[model samples]
Target chain A: MNINLTLIGQSITFAVFVWFCMKFIWPHIVHALDVRRKAIADGLAAAERGKHEQELAAKRATETLHDSKVKAAEIIAQAEKRAVQIIEEAKATAKAEGDRQLAAAQAEIEQAAHRAREQLRSQVAALVLAGAEKVLRREVDAKAHADLLEAISKEI
Target chain B: MAGEAHTSAEYIKHHLQNLVYGQHPDGTWGLAHSAAEAKAMGFWAIHLDTLGMSVLLGVVFLYFFRKAAIRATSGVPGGLQNFVEWVVEFIDGSVKGSFTGRNPLVAPLALTIFIWIFLLNLMDLVPIDWIPGLMGALGLPYFKLVPTTDPNATFGMAIGVFILILYYSVKMKGVGGFFGELAFQPFGKWGMPANLLLEGVNLIAKPVSLALRLFGNLYAGEMIFILIALMFSGGAVMFLTGGVLQWAWAVFHVLIITLQAFIFMTLTIVYLDMAHQEHH
Candidate 1:
């Protein structure tokens, strides 16, 4: 173990190895570690963002569901009001038509009764004139007794 | 069987010696004839085994880690990617805890130091005689496989760290501030000379302790293994006792090697952190 040229050779070798390591090996390893750390951080941040977005979407879906339910209820209430109005209108129309038909029928019945009474009066007058002519055995002077005949007809 | 013709001391001495190449005292540039010859060659000599084994282990470390780096992903990791990420993260945690500076190089430097030293120390666990026996058969007379067991390799790493510490100190505080730090004190400027001596020793102690601590532990561990191997060569009775002892030592040595590597890496980070501090 004398101090010799081997010392110089080993020093040179040590210098070379240290230089190679500083230049090549060390940087790559350190960079890889840093890159991995960054990637993990980014992944964690993305996961947090995704969770927040999911929560927002769920909340929106619940709000939309509630809105649709309210709208459907409003639509159903309006439809019920329209149905009641239509039923009332139909009832009013039917009542008006029945009143008009009843009035017409009553007028027609009164006119028919009046026409039958007139016919009966005229037949009774002719029958009375024929009986008077037969009882008197001659033709009475009808032109001189016009007033009396009118009165007899009125009584009859 | 290799020690069959030699005494225990010779076996241990052979295992401790490195396959060195340098100028001989006879005015020839070649492999050293002996340990004494290798020492005599002085500063010019190279321990081929330490250099070769360390470089090979370093290359292996780089190749696998480079592959893992290429396949690294921001997503979940698997297999080699997982292992690489775990090691990087472990080193990064230690650096983050110990280091206060923002320099990009500290974490990677700590990682390289930890794993590279770990791989170097792991060579000790291999049966002491396996590779040396192989090299012996191939006509190489000596081989010391574990680089950390050699003072040169550990000191080499420590010196490199020391240079970086000095560079950072100068870069952060300028040359005057750097020297001021080395000269100023646990006492005031009135005690400048004492402060200089004390702080100077403190400054020098960082690298010295870093280097020696690792080298001492691993060298001692390697010596013990050599002793155990010597025991194995004694006889059948010694072989059984040696086998049990080697296994127990190796099991315990695992913690030592890992702890030494951790201590080395942590100290480096702490020293660099201290360099970055404006006042400490």
Candidate 2:
């Protein structure tokens, strides 16, 4: 490798190329790389934020579900309680109506029994007074006989 | 200046010369540190043509990044943004694999190295002489296009890394401790002479390997491009074939450039990680 024009040209060219690369090319490359790195970091941060928001929403939904379930159970229990109360009231009202009708029927039966008993007693007294007069074989006054019959009936 | 020896070839040679001032031998690589002739110093100075193109590409990339940054969305990403993200993830994964946790400097440094070197390598894929030729047409002289192709530039980078690695190794393990590790390693508690020799070999090899690997790949690529350009200059048929070949080579070169940059960055991380480790 003698010292020649070609070698000299190559050397000078190499130097110039290097200077250019260092001054212009390398800096841009570095800047681009830096930008890329920052973009990735930003993406990761955004993803993390989104994940956190998703978790928070899930937690809130669970809380709301629990509250709603409790509310539903409370409403059902109240309805059941109201239904039981209405049934008890209807039973009590039916019992009271039945008692009133039974008392009225008993009173009517008693009054009918009393009237029948009075009629029977009167007929029996008349018959007993007739039998006594016949057995004595003598005619008696109607008022006296009626009094004797009444006394006999009372004794019987 | 316009003598018989100072023909067009001489003029070309004069302009092609590195810009070194006084107290420097002629027909040698120019040294900016020495006070040389202003013309010699300028020859070695920055080639503005390639610099402008490289900077233009960089500006374009910057614009792209800014646009992507401003329009970045969480829901869906565009194609360009996706590509950018993929590159970052790829580099991050490689770094993560190479370096252990809590290596605060490793990731950032590795990232910088990867991006910077990747951009440098990508420049090789550009029409190798396109920038320089354009500059020549525009009345500019001594325009070089590729940087890593230069040994000075590659060595400069490798040496910087070499220093950093040494600093870290010493820092992680105290002065006596670091030296002790080398002596005791590989040979294991053997004779002092054998240990010293082996350790010396091991120590010298690290920086040399790093520098040479990069230099070899870049220099070879630059040479091939120059040869191909010379071939195309010969004939029209050769010119068409050269263009086709250049395109194919560029496609293949994409892999080489990207892979080399990745390897370099990965190796750096690995070396730093190893230095921190208690054992090899």
RMSD of each: 3.7, 9.0
Query: What tens digits encode model 2's per-residue C-alpha lDDT throughout B1-280?
Result: 2234445444334333332222223555433332234334433344333344435544555556456555555445689767656665676688778777455566545655566566776777766556655655775444455655545445545655666678888988888778887787666777667888887777667756765777678667766665565556547999898888887878887888777777777887787777776655
Q: List interface RMSDs for the candidates, in order.
A: 0.9, 8.1
In candidate 2 the C-alpha lDDT for residue B231 amounts to: 55
Interface RMSD of 2: 8.1
Worst 10 residues of 1 chain B by lDDT: B1-10
Model 1 clash pairs?
Answer: none
For model 2, what TM-score is found for chain B?
Answer: 0.74
Give the whole-model CA lDDT for all candidates, comma-separated.
0.90, 0.62
Clashes of 1: 0
User: Scoring each candidate complex against the real one, what DockQ results?
Assistant: 0.68, 0.06
- Using lDDT, give the best candidate's number: 1
